[model samples]
Structures are given as C-alpha cells and as structure tokens.
Target chain A: MDNVASLMHGFSVALTTHHILLMMAGVLLGILVGVLPGLGAPNGVSLLLPLTFSMDPVSAIILLTSLYWGALFGGSTTSILFNIPGEPSSVATTFDGHPMAKQGRATEALSFAFLSAGFGAMAGVILITLLSGWVAKFALKFSSPEYFAVYFMTFASFIGLGGASPLKAIVSMGVGFALASIGMDSVSGNVRLTFEFDALLGGVSFLIAVIGLFGIGELIITMEEGLKFEGVQAKVRISDVLRTAAKLPRYWVALLRSSLIGIWMGITPGGPTAASFMSYAMAKRTSRNPAKFGKGEPEGVIAPETADHAAGSSAMLPMLALGIPGSATAAVMMGGLMIWGLNPGPTLFTDRPDFVWGLIASMYLGNVVAVIVVLATVPLFASILRIPFAIIGPIIVAICFIGAFTVASKSFDIWLALAFGVVGYLFKKLDYPIAPLVLAMVIGDKAEDAFRQSMIFSQGSLSIFWSNALVSTLMAIGVVLLLLPLVGMIAQRLRGRTAQSTV
Target chain B: MITRFWAESATAVATMAFGLIIVYGALEFGIGWDSSGPQPGAFPFYTGLLVALASLGTLALTIGRRIAGNAGLQESFLDAERFKRVASFFLPLLAFVVLSVTLGMYVATILYLVFAMRFQGGYGWLPSLATAFGAAAFFYLALEKFFQIGLLKGPLEPLLGL
Candidate 1:
C-alpha cells in the first residue's frame, strides 16, 4: 500500500508536459540512432548525455531512458526488415523475423515484436515497482564490507556465467580496474598512475572509452564485413497491426516464461543479449514443432523480443538499488547518474524518491510511446537505412568524435578515443569480451573504496569481509561463483578421461 | 594475410605488455597496507598483476592450441580483400582525427563528409557539398546554439565573426 501510494506520487511527478515532449523527442532520436549501424543504445545515450548537462536530473533521466526504450524497439525493426540486428540483443530476432518478412508477413512480424516487447517492458517495470522498496530497505543495512562483497559477487558472476574464456574475462576486468585507478585516489589523496602526464590527473573518462569501443569499434567491424542492406520492403497496415495484437495472447505461455527468464537474467547480470538468446533457445526447445522456429514461427519472434525488453528494463533495478548495472547500457546510465550529482544506491531511493520513482513511472509511459511511435514509423526508418553506407558511415564517425570532444573540450580525449577505438576493434575481433571492462570501469573506484574502507575498519585484516553473516554469505557466494568455471572444466576433463579409458 | 594464430598471439602479447606497464606504474606508489588502510597503489597493483597473469594464460593457451595442430588456427583472421576495405575506411578516419585537432571539429566534419560522399560514395559535388554544409550547420545549431555547448573552434571561426 505504501509502495502503491509512492508510485501514484511518482506518476504525478513524471506526468508533466515538458517530460512528455522530451520523451517523444528522445524516442524519435533514439529510433534514428538505433536504425543506423554502429550507433547503439549506449552510444546514443552517451552522445546525448552532454546535451542534458544543463537539464534537471529528472528530465535528463526521462530523455535518456526513453531513448533506451526507443533504441530497443528500433533494433528489432532492422532485424525484421534488413536481416541486420541494430543492437546485439536483437540478433536472435533475425532468425525468424527476417524469414517472416521474406514471406510477406512483415507487418505481422513487426507488430508482434513491438507488442511483445512492450509487454515485457511493462512486466519489468511492475516488478521494479513491487520489489524496489524491499531491495532498497534491505540494502540500507549494508556496510563497507557488504558493499565490497556485492561488487565481488558481480564480477565473479560475470566470470562464471559469461560465455567468454575465464582468463580473457579476468584480463578484461583487470584492465578496466587499472585504467580506472589511473587518476586521483580519493581516500589516500595520491595521484597513482598518471605516469607524469598532466591529462592523467583526472583519469580516463569511461564516456570516452564507451564512444571508442561501441561507436568507432563497431563501425570498423561493419566496414570489414562489407555490409550491404538488401532489405525487405515493409508496408505496415493499421488493420494488420491490430490483427497481430489480437493474436499475441495466444502465446501467453511463451510470453510469461520469457518475461520470467528476462527478469531473472536482468537482475543477475546476464543482460538483454544473453536473455534474448536464452529465451529463443528455450522457446525452440519447448516447441512441439521446433523446425518451424526458423521458418517464420511467431513464437520465435515473440520469445526473444519479450525477453530482450524485459531484461533491458528489469536491469535498472540492480543499478538503482545496489549501484551494480546489469548490462553495458545500464553501466553507462549509472555513470550518468554519478555525473548528475546523484549516487545510485539504496540512499538514492530515500533521498530522491521523486527521481527514482519518476524514472520508474516514465518507463511505463515511455514503452507505450515507443511502441506506438515505432509501429507508425517503421517504413520511415527502413527508408533511412536505404541511405548509402558511405554517407551514413562518415556521419556516424563525425558524431562519435564530436561527442567525445564535447565530453570535456579536450583535444587529448580525441586521441584517447581513437586509441580505445583501435583496442575496441582488436578486442572484438579477438573474441575478448568488452562488457566486463566497461562494468569494471564504472564501478572500479567504488569497489576499491569499499575494500579499503573495510580494511581500515578491520585494521587491514582481510577477515572483515567475513565478520558479519551478511558479508560472509556474500563473500562465500562470490568465491563459489569465481571457482565454478574451474570446477566445471576439471569435471569435464575427468569425464573425458573416463570415456577414453572405456574406449 | 593474418592467421588467427598470429592474431591471437599478438593480442595476447600486447595485453601482457599493457598489464606489465600498469604493474610498473603502480610501483611508484607503495603497494602496502598501513595502519590507515591499504595503500592507493595496492588496488591497482593486484589488478595489474591479475591482468598480466591472465594474459599469460591466454598466450600459453594459444601456443598450446597451435602445438596441438588446431586446424582453425590456420584460418585467416583478415584476408587481403577485407584488409583493403578496413584500411580504406580507417585511413580517412585517421585523417579526420588529425584534422579535428588542427583544423577544428566543425571544419573537419565538413571536409570529412564531403570527401567521403563525393569520392568514396561517388555522389555528386552538389549533393556532397550540400550535405557537408547542411550537416555542419545543423550540428552548430544543435550543439552550440540549442544545447549551449561550444565545440572545438579553429582559426576559421574567429575570422568569420558575426
């Protein structure tokens, strides 16, 4: 009842004329960003971040979150029409989405993707509304040791659960932490890793890193592939959209199951991309006629789309409640939260309920707006994709550089971005996971602070982590997660040895 | 052509070197724990060490795979044609960064777009110049005028003073 009242108040705070207009503009710009290759939700959000510097925190968040929803929707548009996924999360959509388009059911495919995505996002928001208070209250009891334990658990989970080689994951995460510690050490007040360069005083901005990695790095790969867009022409009829919407309820089982999977993944850091793939796999495995999955099955389209948006939205809970982002995009948004003079943790809920709840309330409005706007503008975005890559490509490059420069008006950052861009391209090509790096950079300093603070509390004794039951449980979980992969590998080897002996 | 084996090995070596560099840099500050707490360098030192070790592991794994006659390692990471395409795109991008520093971002934006459109895209001078100027103007209005954020300006902006 208290939570419901708070949400009603949140609705009041978010339901402003200015906010509604900003949401529309954000969605429109986000669709443009999502429709174009090389510009993803993280890139778009970071690029637009500078523009929002002057705005209030509430409006800034509204605009950015709306853009996020819009980008997710726009990603599916390209998947269905061009057979190219605009976002990593949308890749699974192409398996059946493009086939549906080829079969002249483009309208049905588009409508199903958007409507199911909307449903998933709503489910995620409702979960947030219901669970946010309990999470925040639970987190309020946390101390430095608990904080360190949480950060430990997050990184450990990534290494254990992520598909990348554990060694590569560790390397990626270590690089991010090292890079983050380069500038000033707030606790000790010592400049650590400047290497005597003046620019190293403030350290490397994660924003610059993101621009280089996702924006320029992705563009280079796209160029290497020599991509061409031979898109299926989409002609969405209002009647068809209505007809598709009517048929969505028939897949209630898939929708409900996917939403659960998405919410679980979102909260646990598997993220939207992982969630979508897992959901698609589950949908296929459970289907009576699995062969139809890649042959224009509606369930194929519905499952991934639902899970993607569900994970995208639900991921915000951990970011807001515990300051641990569930995905790369959430990591960027959490960075924005720090910049906006707001800390993203349990205190943020009590300190700025209006901001937290308003953002939550806006998610409801934004997804509804995203679906309507995307449904009506599919053809327009498809036509935009028809533009020559040579033109669109250069423009994206320009946007990236411009966005980087605007970060601090430093020419040095332009150079740094280019360097990271090369690193990004090479990392992508080499199968090195970049998310751990981004996540590490975002929370590196905080985690370090938590560890040092806990050490101080225990007079430099590492046992402080296991001092309390809460912290002990958290640390135990982290240790298990960290060792799980190694254990599995050893088990596999033992099994292989047994099989060889039998042979 | 570059094989996957070489590419993997080179990347592993590079990351290893990067980790060692961080480790060295971290030594400047004492990597110790005092009565106050862990030293500033302690965090980075361990992270750097972790990176170095993991990178070594990757390097060893790559070599072990090659030694075991992994056929996939023989495949090309970047063939000649793909290299050509990547270079063509990367060189112009490198030029744009250079121009952004010396010539300023707005002017660089215009010139880069025009060159890409007219030369690379094979579009007409009319459309190229039109797009070049149009995009520059739009960015000027959006970033500078609307957002009130000043972008990098070179000597040209001073001479074209209002």
Candidate 2:
C-alpha cells in the first residue's frame, strides 16, 4: 500500500508541465538518435550528459529515461522498415518485421511492435514498483564483503555467460580493470598509473571511454561496412493500427510470457538483447505453427519487442535498488546518477524517494508518449534511412569528438576518444566481447573500494568473505559462475568420448 | 599482413606483457600486508596476475589450435576491397581531428564535410558545400548559443568577432 501511495506521489511529480515537455523532447531526440546508425542509447546519453550537468537531477533523469524509451521504439521502426536493427535488442525484430513490411503489412507490424513494447514496459514498471521495496530491504543488509561478491558475480557471469569465448571476455575485463585503476585512488588518495602525466591524474573518465568505445568505435565499423541506408517504403494507417491492436488480445499468453522473461533477464545480467532472443526462441518452440514464424507472423514481432522493452525498462530496477546496473546503458545512467550527487542502491530508496518514484512515474508516461510520437511520425523517421551514409558518418564522428571534449572541457579527451576508437574497432574485428569491458570499466572503482574495505575489516584475511552465510553464498555463486565454462567444456569432452566408445 | 590467428596471438602476448608491467608497478607501491591490513598494491597486484594468467590461457588456446592444423591462419584480417573502403573514411577522420585542433570545430567540420560528401558520397560540389555550411551553422547555434557549452575555438573566432 505504501508502494502504491509512493507511486501516486511520483505521478504528481512527473505530471508537471515542464517535466512532460522534457519527456516529449527527450523521446523525440531519442528516436532520432536510435534511427541514426552509430549513435545508440549509451552514446546518446553520453553525448547529452554534459548538457544535463546544470539541470535538476529529476528533470535530467526524466529526459534521459524518456529518450531511452524513444530509442527502443525508434530501433523497432528501422528494423521493420529497413531490416537494419537500429539497436542490438531489435535484431530479432528484423527476422520477421522486415518480412511483414515486405508483404505490405508494415502498418500492422509497426502497430504490433509499438503496442507490445508499451505493454511490456508497463509490466516491467509494475513489477519494479512492487518488488523494489522488498529488494531494497534485502540489500540493506549487505556488507562490503557481500557487495564485493555481487560485483564479482557480475564480472564472472560476463565471462561464463557471454556469447564470446570466455578467455576473450576475461581479457576484455582485465583491460577495463587496468584502465580503471588509473587516476587518483579515492580511498588512499594516492595516484597510480598516471606516471606523472597531468591529464592522467583525474583518471580516465568512464563517459569518455563510453563515447569513444560505442560512439566513435561504432562509426569506424559502419564506415568499414560501407553503410547504405536505402530501405523499404510503407504507409502507416490509423485503421490498420487499430485493427492489429484489436487482435493483440489473442497473444496475451505471449505478451505475459515475454514480459516475464524480460523482467527476469532485466533483473539479472542477461539484459534486453538476451531477453529478446530468449523470448523469441521460447515463442517459436511453443507456438503451434512454428513453420510460419519467419514468414511475417504477428507473434514474431510481438514476442521480441515485448521482451526488449520489458528488459530495457526493468534493467533500471537493479540500478535503482542495488546500485548495480543490469546492462551497459543502465550503467551509464547510474553514472549519471552518481554525477548528480545521488547514490544508488538501498540508500537511493531511503534518501531520494522523490527522484526514484518520479523516474518510475515518468517511465509510464514516457512509453505512452513514445508510442504516439513514433506512430504519427513513422514516415519522417523512416526517411532518415534514406540519407547517404557518407554524409552521416563524418557528422557522427564530429559529434563524438565534441561530446568527448565536453565531458571535462579538456582537449586531452579528444585524443583519448581517438585511441579508444581504435581499440574498439580492433576489439570488434577480433570478436572480443566489449560489454564486459565497458561494464567493468564503470564498476571497477566501486568494486575495488568494496574489496579494500572488506580487507580492512578482516585484517587481510580472505576468509572473511566466507564468514557469513549471505556473503559466503554470494561468493560461492561467483566462483561457480566463473568455473561454469570449464565444467561445461570438460563435460562435453567426456560426452564425446563416451559417444565414440559406444559407436 | 597478419592472419587472424596470429593477430589474436599477438594481442594475448601484449596483454601478458602489460600484466607484467602492472605487477612491477604494483610491487613499487608495496603489496605486503601490515597491521593496517592489505596495502594499496595488493588488489592491483592480484588483478594484474589474473589478467596475465587469462591472457596466457588465450594464447595457449590459439597455439594449440595452430599445432592441430585448425587455426585457420589463411584468413587475413581484412580483404582488399573492405580495406579500401575503411581507409576512405578513416583517413579523412584522422585529418578532421588534426584540422579541428588547428582550425576550430566549425571550419574543420565544413571542410571535412565538403571533402567527405564530394569524394565518398559522390555528391556535387554545390550541394556538398551548402549542406556542410548549414550543418556547421546549426551546431554553432545549438551547442554554443543555446547549450552555452564552449567547444574548441581557433584564430577564426576573433576574425568573426561575434
């Protein structure tokens, strides 16, 4: 009941005229950012972060979160119209969305995609509002050891559960840790890795790293691919949208199932991309007419879109309640929170109830606004796909350079962005998992502080991690997750041997 | 010139080398435990060690595959046509960075835009130049006037004297 009351209070805060305008502008820009290749949610947020430095924390968060919702919708538009996934999570949407567009059902597919996304986001927000208090209360008991264990679990899961090779993931994470260890150590106040260079003293900013890695790095790869933006043409209609929306009740099972999958993945570290893929696979396996899945099926569009938005929205829950982000974009948003002088985790709920609830309230309004804006302006956003890549590419690079410099108003960061761009380009080429590296970069300092705090508490005794059941259980999970790949490899080898012997 | 396998192998070796350097650096900061508990170097020392070990593991995997004749060494990093395309825009980007440093963001942006659009985009000189000027003017108004953020400026600012 208190939670519901708090959410209602949040609605009062969110429904202010200024806040609504900010949300509207944010969603519009977010769609533009998403439609543009090489500029994603993280990059968009990073680029705009410097501008929000002077704004109130509540408004800043509303704008960014609304933009996030808009980007999700925008990515879907490109997927349906161009077969080009504007966001990584929308990859599965293209598998069937483009096919639907091909069959002259683009309006139906577009309507289904946005409506499902709206539904999924609503479900995710409801779950977060219901579960956050309990989760916060549980997390309030965590000590430094347990905190360190959680961070370790995140890194370990990236290694164990990543699509890339485990060794490659470790290498990426290791590099991130090394980069994070530079600049001034917050606890000891001692400089490490600067080698007396003036620019290295403040350390490498995660914002700069993110801008370089995702923004500039993606530009290089797109340039390499010789990007072409010409896409399929379609006209959306109100009647068609209504007709398709009227049919949405039949897939209640899929909508609910995908929302559940998305919520689970969002809370965990699997993220939206994984959730969408998992939901689509589950939908395909369970559907009666699996053969029709890739041939422009409405369920195909709904399952992934629903799960993607659900996961994207719900990923914020962990960040708000636990100070841990479930995805890279969430990590950047958490960084923004830290910049606004707000601490995430249990303290966030206790200290800043207004901001928390306000953000939650805006999520509800933002998605509704996103659906309306995207539907009304599909042709305008879709036409962006027709712009020549050559013109778009250089401009993106310019934005990245300017964005990096604005982070600290330093010329040194422009060079840093260039260096990391090369690193990002190479990492992509080598099939290295970049997400773990980015996540590690953002969280490394906090994790290191937690480790050192635990050490100080235990007088250098590592066994302190196992002294309590909570910390010990978390540590055990971390270790198991880290070793899961090895165990799987060995089991596979054994199975292969047995099969050969039987043969 | 390097094959994909060798390139990855080199990356692993470089990682290992970096780890060794970190370990040496951490030693100077003192990794020893004391009454105050672990020292500053303790965590970094171990982190470096972990990095070194994992990188070695990657290197080992690459080598093992090579010995088994399954390393796929014949695959080059980038084919000829792809390399040509990447260099087209990449070289201009490098120029744009240097030019921005010397010529301010606005002028540098205009020049780069015209060049990229004309050469890479195959646009006519008039359209390319007009679009470049339009974008530069918009950015100046939006970023500088509205947002009140000062980007890099060069000698051209005083000449306009706005």
Candidate 3:
C-alpha cells in the first residue's frame, strides 16, 4: 500500500504540464517516425538525444521512453493497414493484416489489433511495476561475477533464441565485443585498440554503429528491392473499428496467448520478431480452423499483431530494469538514458524512482494517446502507401543524412554516416542478423568491465561465481540456456535413429 | 541459399581475422600498466578472444552443416521488386554523401533530388527540379533559419549572406 502511494508521488512528477507536453510531442514524433521507412523507434530516439541534454533527467527519460512506446504502436498501423511493416516487430502482421484489408475487413482487423495491443502493453506496464521490485532485489544481490555471468548468458542466448543458428549469433556477438574494445580501455586507462588513429580514440560511438547496422543497412536493402508499395485500398472508418461489431470473444484465447508469447520473448531478449513468429505459429497450431490461416484470416493478423506489440512494449522491461536492452530500439533508448546522465538498473528504481515509475506511468498515458491518435489517423498514414517509393526514397535519405549530421555537428560524423551506409548495405546483402552486432556493441564494454572488475575484486578467483547463491542460480540457468539447443539436437537425432532401428 | 550462406560465412571468417588484428593491435601499448583497477589489455584481450572463438565456431558449424547434407538455407524475407527500387536510389544516396562534403549540403541535396527523381523515380524534369529546389529550401529554412543551426553554408550562401 505504501509502495502504491509512493508510486503515486512519482506520477505527480510524470503528469506535470511540462512533462505532459513532452510526452505528447514524443508520441506524435514517434508516430511520424514509425510511419517512415528506415526509421524505427530506436533511430528516432537516438536522433532526438541532443534535444534532451538540457532537460531534467525525468523529462528526458519520459520523452525518450514515450517516443519508444509510441513508435512501437505506430509501426503496427502501417503493417496492418498497408502491407508494410514499419518496424521489424510488425512483420508478421503483413501475413494476414493486408489480406484482411483487401477483403474489406480493415475496420475490424485494425480495431482488434489496436485494442489488443493496448491491452497487451498495459499488461506489460503492470508487470514492470509489480515485477520490477522483485527483479531489482535479485539484481542488487549480484556481485561482479554474477554480473559477468548474466552478461555472458544474455549474449550467449542471442544465439540460443535469436532466430539464427546458435553459432552465427555467437560469432556476430563476439565480433561486436571485439569492436567494442577498439578505443581507450575504461578500467586501466590505456590505449588498447586505436592503432594510433585519432578518430578511434573515442572508440565506436553507439550512434555510428546503430546508424550503420540498421539505418544504413536498411537503406541498402531498400535499394535492392527498390521502392514499391502494394498497400491495400480499403475504406476503413473509426466507428467501424470502435463498434466491436465482430464477436471475437472466442478469439480472446488467441489474443491472450499471443500477448503471453510476446511478453516472454521480450523478457528473454528474443525480440519482437521472435514473438511475432512464435505467436503466429502457436495461433495456427491451436486454431480449430488451421487451414484458414495465412489466407486473410483475422486470427493470423490478430495473433502476430497483438504479440508483436506486446513484445515491443514489454521489451522495455529488461532495458529499464537491468540496463540490458531486449531489442535494438531499446538499446538505442539505453543510449538516450546515458545521454541524459541517468543509468538504468536497481538504482533507477530507488534513487530515481520517479524517473523509472514515471516512465512506466507514461507508458499507460502514451498508449492511450497512441491508440486514439493512430485509430483516428490510420487512413491518412495508410494513404502514404499510395505515394511512389521513388518520391519517398529521397525523403528517407534526406532524413537519414540530416539526422546523422546532427550527431556531432561536424563534417566528420557526416562522412562516418555515409561510410556506415555502405557497411549497412553489405550486412543486408550477406544475410547477417544485424541485431546481435548492434546489441553486443551496446553492452560489450559494460559486460567486459563487469567481468574484469569481478576478477579484480575477487583477486582473480574464478570460484566467486559459485560462492554466491543468487549468482550460482543465475549462472546455472545461463549454462542451461546455452546448452539446451545442443541437447535438443542430440535428442532428436537419437529419436530418429531409434525409430529407424525399430523399423 | 546454402551457397550464399557459405559465401557470407567466409566473409565473416575474414572479418574475424581483421578482428584478431585489431585485438592484437590494441594490446601493443603494453595493454595498460597494471593498476588498482584493471589492466587495459584485460578487457580488450577477452573481447578479442570471444570474437575469434565465436566467428571460428560460426564458420565451422555452418560448413559442418553443409557437409552433413543440409540442402539449403530456408526462405529469405526479401521482396525482389521492392528491393530493386530501393537500390537505384540508394547508389545515388552514397554519391550524395561525397557531394555534400565537397559541394555543400544544399547544392549536393539539389543534385541528389534531381538524380533520385529522374532516374530512380522516373519523374519529369520539371517536377524533379521543382522537388529538388523545394526540398533544399525547406531544409534550409527548417534547419538553418528557424532552428538557427549554422550549417556549413554553400557557395551560394556566401554570396547571399543574410
């Protein structure tokens, strides 16, 4: 009860006039960004980092995190109304969503998606509020060994749960960690990797890496496919969606199931796409009418849409709670947190209780705003699908270049941005999962420091990892996560061999 | 798809070599004098090791799977026609980066818009030129005049220094 009241105090700060205005602006801007190709919630948040430097920590976090939530919501609009998935998380929506639009069920599909997404996101926020206290207590008990072990498991699991082969994910992460070590060393204060290049002195900037891997990479891939929009031409109205004319209560099972799928993926760092695909698969298998899936089935659309939104929104959990980002956008938000001079962790819930909880409260507020704004304006953004990609192409490029230059107000950063654009193109061509690289770079340094500091604190004792009960438990879980895939493969092979022998 | 996977896998293998060189290079300056905190090489060395090990494992596993009769990597998410359109405009975008630093953002943008619209977009010259100038003007006003951002003005700006 006391805790709830204290959280209410946090709400007072979050609901201030200035804070409210910033949240509004963030939500609006995030939607615009989400609608645009090549710009996700993360990129928009990063591009806006400079603007937050002068603001108080609470408002800064509010602005960035709200922008993040809003962008995730914004992404689904394009995915459902048109065939375009504005963010990666919304990809599954195109499977059934666009088809539903073509069949003139856009109103129902759109409304279901929005309502369930809001419900899912609201659920995620509550989970954060209730679970954060317990999670933080567990996190606070971690020493350096436990911290290193946690980082290890998270990075390793990128291979485990990231839709790629375990080996490829691991390689990508390892390379990222190496790249992270390129500048001056943090602990010993020595020049480790620069090779005497002055530009390398600052090490790789998170801005540079993200712009290259995602923004630029997408730009290249965008070129390969060229610009085309086969968006649905539907006459969807607000009332049609708001009416709840369709009795989808039976599908509530799908919606809830998908939401759980999303929240699990988000928390485990599997990301939105994972949630989308998993929920889509689960919804199909569980459906009484499986054949209807992928053929404009509203179930297909609703399942992935609800799950993606849930995953995208719930991924915020890890980012705020443990300072470990569950998705690229969340990773970018982490940078925004650093820029605002507020580090996220257990301390975030304590010292900056208002900042953390306020951000949570703002999630509720921003989600309502996003639902209203998006539902009202879906037709307008969907109309953008009609614009020729040729026209939209130049506009996106202009935004990318301009946003890149703003990072340093220097010509050099502009050049770096262009260079990254090429690298981005290459990564896309090669089929490399860009997220692991980006995510690893974001946390590589911290993870390394955590490992070394633990060692130093333990006088080079490797056994400290097992000395603490919490650390031991987490490490055991991490080891299981790492080995589970291999074990599964072995079990499958054995089953196959035994069946053949019996035959 | 299997072949393409190997091709990319090879590239990553090469990248690992580059990464190894970087790790070694960073440690050359004695990897920091051992201090109360941590030796400088300590972190970099471990990161480098992880990269080498991970990349090596990735290449090996990918190859191993191929040899084990894994026929092909499964379906790709890319849409071909959509990809083609983005590429044409994308090439010129790289060119725009070079032009911006040399010629200036405004003039470079004008050129980029013209190229993008005419070639990639298949738009008429009049609309293309109109778009080029209009875009430049809007950006100039939004970033420079309204935001008061002092962009590295073009040759034209020097003449019309307001």
Question: Model 2 off-target regions past 4 Å?
Answer: B34-36, B71-73
Summarize candidate 2's per-residue lDDT along B19-92 as a digit string, tens digits: 77777777777788766666777777877888899889989988888888884755887778778877887788
Top candidate on TM-score is 1
Candidate 1 lDDT by residue in tens digits, A1-503: 87889999988988999999999999998888888999999989989887887889999999999999999999999999999999999999999999999999999999999999999999999999999889999999999999999999999989998888899999999999999998889898998889889988989988999999999999999999999999999988999999999999999999999999999999998899999999999999999999899999999999999999999999999999999999999999999999989999999999999999899999999998899999989999999999989999999999999999998889999999999899999999988889999999999999999999988889988889989899999999999999999999999999999999999
Second chain of candidate 3: TM-score? 0.78
**Docking quality class, candidate 2:** medium
Give every collision pair in model 2: none
* Model 3 quality (TM-score): 0.92
Give all candidates' CA lDDT scores: 0.93, 0.87, 0.74
lDDT, ranked from best to worst:
1, 2, 3
In model 3 chain B, the worst 10-residue window by lDDT is B73-82
**Candidate 1 stretches greater than 4 Å from native:** A498-503
Reference contacts recovered by each candidate, as fractions?
A: 0.95, 0.63, 0.69
DockQ of each: 0.90, 0.67, 0.54
Distance from true location, Cα of A49 in model 1, Å? 0.9
Candidate 3, residues A1-503, lDDT tens digits: the string is 64577568767778788887887788778877787787777678767776566677778878887787677767877887767888888888878877777787877777777777777787677777778777876778766787788777787677666656676666667667777777767766676677767777767767766765667667667656644677765555756875753556667898789888888988888888888888999999998889988778888877887788787778888887788888887887776787677787777777787777778777777778777776777777777757777777677677667766666666666667776666666656765667877788788778888877887777777787888777888788888888877888899999999999999
